[model samples]
Each structure stands twice: as structure tokens, then as C-alpha cells.
Target: METRLSLRYTGPAVDEGLMDVYQASANMIAFSEFMVTAVKATFGDAADAKANVAGFGKGSFITDLVFSVGGPAATIFASFTSDHLVTVLQEAFGLWKHLKGSPPTEVNQSGQSVSVTNNTGQIIQVQTDTLNLVFSEKGADSVGRFIKDALNQTGITGVEIASKGEPVAHVAQHEADYFVPVAKESPVSENVVTMALILVAPVFQDGNKWRFSDGTGTSSFSAAIEDQTFIARVNNGERFGKGDVLTVEMRIVQTRTSNKISVERVVLRVLEHREAAQQPSLV
Candidate 1:
């Protein structure tokens, strides 16, 4: 079990640079120290620089380390690396377990997805959270075969399997166009939408109505809530004040008597809530 982990800096702001030369050098040296310590922990200094090897490209901020192990020993080493990396990085990174004789052909990471080509030349797309795993065409068939074989070994066979069926159906049903379709109300109301914004005014209750501004150029909006859930969470032992950041799900209901203004109904579904000190997302 060989675990590989990495981090890279890439952004549109080239002027910002990856890191200062001095800081880059310092980070690389610190990471190299960690690699050496990891190797020593796995092999108890016997392997040293021989079987447990680590190298860094000249003037680069990356390290390529490899450990040769077999059978249960490999599994132990992998578990060690997994835990070690998390402890060292404080759970800010993740590792890939590389089985002997089957190293990945390619590895790429992005803001939303991580793509890896397994040794068998099949692609695996994994989300950062590791909850959604998508295997390529060949990869999916290979996994299905493995699962079928496992089921056979346990005297359970011929089971139906499907991945991504729900998402496919959901998209087809919602996004597909048809001549005659089922009549239904829109999931998103006529003027209802979600907003993530910085509050410019303190949230205060006047009877059943709450008034606040989202710091937008447009005029502020007021909402009336019957459900106590939204305000309960907003209060959070204290009232939400100005400058706090929030993601709100609201409904835009037309006013019967007014044409110029509409009521924004708080749905009580606080998608996100944070203190004023938290920075608003720029991306």
C-alpha cells in the first residue's frame, strides 16, 4: 500500500505567484522532512534511503516518494501513511492508495473533481468529499464484474446493479422537453430564488415581519415568517446583526394591493449561516 498525496497552487492571478521563493523553499523543506519521517516510521530506519526513497525536483515544490512493500506489510504501510498524512496536514489533504504493480497512469485535481487513470487504463472521477464516485465506461463495467464475482463467492448472484440512475431520471424528467407533459407547479416559485449575501443591516423583528438589507445596490427586502425555525437558528442564542453573511432560501410572493413591491417570504431553510468575521466567497 503506497499512499500518494499532493497540493498545487494555480490561479488566474499570475502576479500573485505560487509562493515566494523563500516560502516555497521553506515549505518544500518542511514537506521533505515529513517524508523522511514517514519513511522512517514505516521501516524503522532499516530501509532508510534505499527501499524507502523520497526525492524532490530541483527548485520545485513537489516530492515523489515511493515505498516498496508486499502483502499485509503493504496494507499496514498504507494505513500508516493515511493516518500519518492526516495528522501531519491536520486533515486538509487526502491520499491515494496505490496497489503494487498497478500505479495510476495520470492524476489531476481541480476545485470540484479529482481525476485519476488507474493502472488498467480506466478513469475514476471522485469528488473532493469522496461521496460521489464516477468510473468511466470501462471502469464501470470492470467494477460491475468484480461486484458480480464477489456476489457469486457469497452465494448471491444475478443481482441488478445501477449507478447514476436516479440523477439520469431526474434530469430527463425535469430538463427533457415533450409535446404533452404533466402539468405541475415550478419547484422554484415565480419569483423565488436563493441568495448568498452580506447583510448590511441588523436583523430585527417588528411583529411577525423581519427587515434587513443584503447590501445589494437595490433596495432592501422584508420578510414575514410564521415558522419559528428560521429566526430560531438566526438568533442562535443571540440576534443576527449587521455584516453577517448568510445564504437564504426565500419565496417572492406577489402583493395583492401593491404593484411596486412584493413580499419576500423566508422559507426558514438557512442553507448557510456564518458570523461577520467569515469572509464572503469570491468564487
Candidate 2:
């Protein structure tokens, strides 16, 4: 499905309807990344999508891009027409603009309505659907920063993005920085659990996360080694090769800001290590 969107960059530099290829390419990459990231955030990770430039020209240096979805995303939108897709992106940009960069201080969902509290404790109410974009994986803030930062570069005085039949959402050059994602981190929850994890890939370097598979060996994840004794033993010549299963006590931390969700795990104790059966070498 193709949903058309337009982006117009206006400034003295674009007055001649010409832009340096290098700058144009940078802007294009940033914008395209935003589209891909936004789709995944709003529509869930199953979305395999792309925003292709349909047309571009001088005259304020505008470009028309077509959003197309495939794979699981198509199934998710089986009932949604092309018009619905356009509305989807429109809402994404709207919420991105509404947040202006900072993540909500608190969010409460009740039925189809939501209460969002900003940094200053100002409570604003919005529909649940309007927030699927901002309240998704990392929210729209992370994607907004990079795209807006790209526009802030060069001689871009302002930018406007819109889909058909929608009012233009404007971003002044000065306001580009206004979309910077919050750098602060807030802890959500933490817990310790003992499990046997098969090492997928172990980082040999200090202060790095080691990869492992879940106890059921069905999923994989990465965690840091906070067990000093285990690290010391490894440093002293302990072998923890790929496919070795380690029964460990791991502390899992869940953190988030308005931008995204983060989960960090630390191996607090290493209880057992079972090596994968090694083939005998014929001498």
C-alpha cells in the first residue's frame, strides 16, 4: 500500500530550487530513517516498510514520498485502506510534534483516553490511538531528533511535512533542537532470577555485555557480568566458550524515558557451566 507524503524545505538556499547533492542526500537518509523507525515504533516490530521518494523538484525544494508496507505489516493492516495508512503517518508526526522532545513525566491509560503529564506537571488528555506513535517502543522522540537534526544542518530555514488533506506541520530551523530526545534515564523495575543460559557469544572485553540464550533456549539476550569472582576466574584462564550453558543469578533492570524502553541484565552469580559436547580429535 502506498501513502503519499510531502516534505518541503524552504530557505534562501532553496530559493533557487537547487540543493547541494551532499546535503540533499544527508537529509534524505535522515528522513528515510525516520520513516522506517517510526513505522516500526507505531505498528510494532513486524512492520517491514519503506518510504520511497515518488517525486522531487525545485520550487521550495519539495519531495513527495510514498510509504509502502509489506510482510506482517500488511496482515496488520488488512482492513486498513491506503487512506488509513496516510492517517497513520499523519498521526505519528502529530504526536512527535506534540512532545517537542521531552518524554512524558507520567502516562495513565483509562479506556480509550490517556492522560499525559509533561515535565512541568501539565496534564494533557489525548486519544489512545494518537499515542501509539509516541508511546511505542522508544516513542517518536528518538526518530525525531535525528531527522530534525539533519534539517537543522545546511541552510534549511524551515521544513513542512504533510499528507494529502492534512494541515502542514511546520518545523522552524530554530525549533530543530526542540525535538532533541531526552537524555535522562529513569528506572522502571528490577528483579533477580536464576536460570540456565546457553552462551551465544561472550564478549571477552571488560565492561561489555555477553550474549546468551534464555533457559528454554528459545530466545537470546545480552547481559553484563557483574560477578567479580566469575570475571576474575575468566581473566585467570577460565574458558566460557559459545554453546556453554551457565546457570546464573541475573538481575534484570527495566528502564524507560519518553523516548524508549531499555532492559539491562547483570549476571550476579555464576552457579554452573556445562560445556557443549566436544568431538574427539583423532590423533
- Using TM-score as the measure, the top candidate is 2
For model 2, state the Cα shift of residue 172 in Å. 1.9
Candidates' TM-scores? 0.26, 0.55
- Residue-level lDDT tens digits of model 1 in 8-41: 3222221244334554444444444544444453
lDDT of 2 at 81: 57
Worst-scoring 10-residue span by lDDT in model 1:
166-175
Off by over 4 Å in 1: 1-189, 203-206, 234-236, 256-261, 278-283
- Candidate 2 per-residue lDDT, tens place, 1-283, comes to 5556666678877886556767677666666666666555445566566666777756223334344456766777566455554555565555555556777777789996777776877776765655665555443444454357556666668777666636446777766755655434689999999988889998879999999988574778888888899888889888878789999999999988555678988899999889977989998
Compared with the true structure, all predictions reach lDDT values of 0.40, 0.67
Tell me how far the alpha carbon of residue 153 in candidate 1 is from the true structure, in angstroms, after superposition.
91
Error of 2 at 197 (Å): 28
